[model samples]
Target: MRASEDAGLRDRRRELLTGARGRVLEIGAGTGLNLPLYPEQGIVELVFTEPEEPMARRLDERAHARSPVPRVVRAPAEDLPFDDDSFDTVVSTLVLCTVGDQDAALREARRVLKDDGRLLFLEHVRADDAAGARRQDRWHRPWRAIGHGCNCNRATVPAIEKAGFRLEHVERGTVPKAPKIVRPLAVGVAVPA
Candidate 1:
């Protein structure tokens, strides 16, 4: 997934994270892909949280080897161990689709973010077409099981909007070489509503 995503997406991730500043928290850090993208000068600190033990260990190892170390915590997105309005930026990348509770996790993101904080996201979402959406739902159970709880047909955009974040920008596209049910993607920034 990482290799294919990088090969296809170009500089989208870099474009999204380079401008991030102040105290930042990234949910579902995975293999710490976003770790190196954040700017060296503006960022004060970075906290990466991952629920999966294996992924968290890898994230720790990756962050440890980097110049500016990030504090990695093993925790689910729905239950972040941070104070209210504690961070300046909250980031999520290719994670919302797999989160067990998308609504709860997003609420947590909003809670931990300062009033002026922004949420940056790159997520695969449900298709716009009706037939494709049905296919996504039809295959959801098995897909989720195989994809580590990922809802290939997840409605990420509406979920984000419903989380009460005032969207600053959002762009939709398709992932290359992926099935139609899992191809739709959304990338953007949002602030607390």
Candidate 2:
């Protein structure tokens, strides 16, 4: 089931990242799973922010293995170690739900992105359905304990909007073979207005 869920996530991530170009910053680059999916054309450079030491090491190894090496930094999303407006694109995949402070992380993402820069995301968020929402609330506590503090109940889209981004495109749906309660996946692009 986990494998199937991961496969679904990979497909969705690929679709969302297809047209990425220029300097891109990817938050929570866990194990660098998204590294190989990046588009070859248009993208000039890639930067990854990962706080976990082990994961960062793996990401570094993956970057070095790539034809064009990507920059990998060990840092938290809420406090980016970069100049303001430093990237043409910012991306987060399955990241927002585990952030210690979603608003702060989002603000950092907005700060690093250029005025017209795009924010692309592939996140698993709280369900909009009432029954599903209830189920999510029930499962989230136990899930968080085992899933590295990740919550299935975080409303990622609204949080992004509240952090001062204008949604340009959005597609939400359930990931295959996963519990409907916690499988509300949102893929979209936003920009700071």
lDDT of each: 0.88, 0.89
In TM-score terms, candidate 1 sits at 0.95
Clashing pairs in 2: none
Candidate 1: which pairs clash? none
Those runs of model 2 whose alpha carbons end farther than 4 Å from true positions after fitting are 5-7
Q: What is the C-alpha lDDT profile of model 1 across 1-193, one tens digit per residue?
A: 7654666753777788975789999999888987877788888889999999999988999999877788999999999999999999999989999888999999999999999899999888998999989999999998987887888988888888899898899998877667677888888999999
Cα lDDT of model 2 by residue, 93-116, tens digit? 989999899999999999999998
What would the TM-scores of all predictions be?
Answer: 0.95, 0.95
In terms of TM-score, how similar is model 2 to the real structure?
0.95
Cα lDDT of candidate 1 equals: 0.88
RMSD of 2: 1.4
Error of 1 at 150 (Å): 0.8
